[model samples]
Target chain A: MAKTIEEINEKIKAGKAVVVTAEEIIDLVKQKGTKKAAQEVDVVTTGTFSPMCSSGAYFNIGHTKPRIKLGGGRAYLNDVPAYTGFAATDILIGANALPDDDPRNRVHPGEFNYGGGHVIEELVSGKDIRLVATAYGTDCYPRKKLETWINIRDLNQAVLFNLRNAYQNYNVAVNLSDRTIYTYMGVLKPDLGNINYSSAGQLSPLLNDPYYKTIGIGTKIFLGGGIGFVAWQGTQHAPNVLRSDNGVPRRGAGTLAVIGDLKQMKPRWLIGTSMLGYGCTITVGIGVPIPILSEEILKYTAVSDEDIFAPVVDYSGAYPQMKSDILGEVSYAQLKSGMITIQGKEVPTASLSSYPRAVEIANLLKEWILSGKFQLTKPVAPLPGVESGITFKPLKERPIED
Target chain B: MVVSKRIVLHFPRRVVERPIVYRLVKDYDLEFNILKAFFTPEEEGLMVLELSGEQTDYDKGINYLTKAGVRIQSLSQDVIRNEERCTHCGACVTICPTGAFELDPLTRRINFYNEKCVACVLCIKACPPRAMEVHF
Candidate 1:
């Protein structure tokens, strides 16, 4: 009863397609097994809405009335800096960029209140943001400065060109220090008082499509509110991470460089967030529809919170550190239950990733599939899935200047 | 006639040294849970407390506190979740100290259980849409 992509599309065309969410697919497979579930479910919709630091939006600001050349350093949008290095009018805004008057250090250690992420959120929410730029009056461009307000509608081309997203999997964080640590992972209560994780678990796109055969270049997805595509293999895509018998990555693996038209996105699907001490990040809402190609694909979609696990690491030191405190493996279900025993102490668990939003995105994609409004893309290029040893190295470890 | 209510209890300096909270349970036969407590250097005490018991015992507990100069205020106060603004992302579900927020497994919707909310305000800032608001 293995279904092909064409067969699924035919079912969708006939308006008789059976679609299930990543959560529902879990039960369907557990009861009927992969073969039966593959026959029953044609598509499994997955989603995740979490803060991704490697995200940015580009805009073709078009020609200012006097053709002002943006000379890089002095340009801002709604009090947030825009990378003017792109072109005279075209500018890029990184989600993590902070405003000049943010008053970060002026306050307590962690409280980075707002910046580019907030501006992006406001823009998506359909609010106007001030756009200011200055360039020493160039003889060729002939403009010194410009200051105006622009909304998404005014821009000729506004696109969300995120470089990295849909992280295959992530770590669970626990702070063992005496003081509360504010991190992009959320506020960590000290003394292993709490644990915070940031994955939608079963609903996450990369989790459902453990192997990128079904989710690769040109794969259609729900980016923000509008349909988008996986532009490329995301930066730091380690297709080579170790996997469980289930074929799901056991560590950080592949990611996505997603892109979508800004005009088609909704404010609810995107947000700007400020971590009190951890700076800023844009919470991106992404949903990818996984068409059940066969029994194998069905099994991947069946991953549940109780099934997928992450290691708990200590954030008291520099992050992304390979060494972990080895708090042991725990499932998303236990984490969501609100507490887990770390070092024999009952520590509360929290998640920076929003499950409700992820579910909403999944359901939204489901509706699109049922209504035949969205079509699933067969990957043109397969993403790497095996263990790749291509470790990025910094140019020569810093040695004494001999 | 058992009931539960959340209230803010302020103890003056003179009463700070007294074990009034312990006395409420021993003398009045009432149950109390302290959600938060702040003991000032000046010996003043502030607490967000929930008390439960039979109507008679609860009344006696209130009487004992008032007679001892403990000022009390009810916490009808709550955090407001703007229905229009909430996208039901379930971000608050995991962070709530009191398990006030949870996702409905069947519908995949975030449910706010007010009865369990201690108003720690963790979700207020966590809410991306600025949907969760606190009103004390």
Candidate 2:
């Protein structure tokens, strides 16, 4: 029995939709099989809340008093650098942008605090931030310097227009070096002591919709606390990465660069952060709904942690080179168990990605979709596909070990 | 009783010559695990240690260090989270070894149970909001 989007929409309209989270849909498909589950289920919600480094927000702060025509000025938002290159009162903040005077090198991870990501979090939380800008005085709107505290409420337009985020799957990091290493994947101890991987696992948006069928441009999504849309193909949107038998990518593949209104966002869904010696990053709670239009789609949504595999990379070295020595393939189940044996030593594993929060986001999105409170947009365009060519080879040519 | 606690041991250059940790183990009959220890170029030292022993012995061990002029501060005083700064995103809930941070389930918010925390300092870095803080 095959399902169709039209029938699913009807079910949703009549308040008779059978919606299940990606995790629950897996069990449903396993018990009832894909055909039956596909016919019975209307929608499956998928979510991932992780520190996406490729995230940023654009703010049109509107005009300042005396209207500064600051063609080029130095702008600081709560001591963090803001991209004030453009005219008007517009500023862009990258998620990884660190404050000019960040004390990251001086202290350890927890103490070296605020950065651009933190500024975003504070804005989302409705907290005020010191906004300062200085420019060479222009005759049109001669105001050389202006300083004021601003909040999200006062901004004309505050929207999250990230270039890339929500990776299909990512590398698991471990350090083989002798000293402690600080990375975006948290602090890795010397000699492969601890392993850290970041992804929401089964609940991740890309994992649930592997081929980018239901998650393309214009798709309405849960961005932070509010509804958002996939504006365009994400940067480095690679779809040709090598895959396992189930179509799940073995490495980083398929990404979504999402956009959403800042006014509608809730503080709890977006947070800013600074890592010791690693700069800044923001954790975003994103949820996308995959309509169960057919048995094929249902099966895709049913992919679980045990079925998904990723390569462990040594971030202690540079990339492309890290691709040369693949540190064995392991499933999300193995990674989540908190331990993996590498080089005959028991290495503890930790996920920078939050599975608990991912599940919560999925469940919340499920309720939102089922209640007909959210609009599900059809894709305006498909993401990049296999035609683009795989960036690197993975898995297939594994040198048969002894 | 084999109870355990986390403490920071500071060794000023003047006290660096003293046998502070050795006496705690041998004389006070306490077990210690050094989470991390660092010596500055000036010879000042700061060590994060987990000390365990009978309740009376642990107290005596800590007292002995205070009298030796070795500053000791509890882990609870060092590892803290600013509730206002936290988004309750639960990023720390998954990385926490001792279940100190957990999901409320009903509210679906991450809650902090500081009592169960081991202060391994893992959550401090894992936290995306930078909400879980460590005070020196």
Candidate 3:
């Protein structure tokens, strides 16, 4: 049997919809079978909470007193540079942007305690932010210098517009070098002292909808603890990749570009993160509700940690050189068990993503649907899938003349 | 009763040259394991070590250190995890040498055991949220 999103929305409106988290749907399918579970369940909510380097926010801070033209000017939010190339009073702050005085890697294993991400988190938390700008004088907007304190509530508009997020899968990073190395994957101890992986696995949004069956452009979702929408197929969207028999990508594949109103988001879900020796980013919480339109879709949603696998890649050499070399592949079940055996050596594993927070976000999204406060939307268009023959490519460095 | 306690000793510049930790073993009959020590000539010094001895001897050893003008504090007081900032990502669990962090099997939340922490400060950098802080 098959169901339509409209039918599911009708049930949600009538308070008759049956909703469960992606984790719960696994056991449900095991007990009731895919066919029965699909018929019985209306929605399966998936979640992931992890540091995404591609995230950032843009804001319109409203016109300044006497009008300062900031479109082509320099702007700093809490001493971190922001892109002011848009309109006057509008600025974009990337999560990875660092302050001018940040020593960065000059001091080995630098402490990037604060950056643009921290500024965003502070703004969302309703704290005052110091805005400093220097503009070239203009005829219509003649003000040259401006410095003020702004809050999210007083901003004309604040929106989180991430270019790429919700990675389908990622590599498990380990160091095989002689000494410890720091990376975006956190610190990797020497000789595989510890393994670090970041992904929600079965509970991940894109993993459940691996083929982009339902999740696509304009699909409403829970972003940073607020209602948001998938804007487009994310940057570096590589759908053509190795997959297990269950259709889940075996490596980092599809991604989503999400957008949401920053005013509605909570600071808890949008947290500032500083990776020692690496840089700063934000940990964003996102949840996507999958409507069980068919038994096949339900079966995909039932994918568990045991069936999901991630490649273990050495960060010291292969990762830095962009070589596709993997030490081994391990299941999320094994990774989550705290230990994984690679090269016949028992290695302890850790997760950069918060599973407990992912569960909470999924449950919260389920509650929103059950209370009729949220509704599932049919995607306006589908993301390029395996059939599209789209493959992610690396940059080709060439001579300027060529 | 025998007890093992990790403590930090602060040496003022006047007593910087004194061999204070050696007296804990010779005079008080306590076993000391120095975890970290830093001192410059004619300057203040600091040492973190775990001392194990009989309760009476341990008290006497601490008393002797106080008489020597060396400030004493618990080693656990040096490093701390900010509970409000911690998201329980388990990044500190595997990196901790003493297994001071554990993820609850049922709740999947991180449970920190400060008593087991040796204050190695490995978790201070590993934590993504910068939750682990070192006061020293």
Off by over 4 Å in 2: A1-6, A103-112, A318-323, A388-402, B1-78, B81-127
Best by TM-score: 3
Q: Rate the local accuracy (lDDT) of all candidates.
A: 0.81, 0.80, 0.94
Instruction: Return the TM-score for candidate 3, rounded to 2 decimals.
Output: 0.98
lDDT of 1: 0.81
Worst 10 residues of 1 chain A by lDDT: A387-396
Worst 10 residues of 2 chain A by lDDT: A317-326
DockQ of each: 0.27, 0.24, 0.81
**Candidate 1 runs further than 4 Å off:** A1-4, A71-73, A318-325, A391-396, A399-402, B1-74, B83-130
lDDT tens per residue, model 3, B9-120: 8899999887887888999999999888889989989888899999999999999999999999998878888988999898888888999999887788999888888788
Q: Per-residue alpha-carbon lDDT of model 2 for B8-118, expressed as tens digits?
A: 888888888777889999999999988778776569888888899999999899889888888887776778998766655554654676778766645546778766765
RMSD of 1: 5.1
Among residues 3 or more apart in sequence or in different chains, the pairs in candidate 3 whose N, CA or C atoms overlap within 3 Å are none
Best by lDDT: 3
**Which pairs of residues clash in candidate 2, taking residues 3 or more apart in a chain or in different chains?**
A117-A272
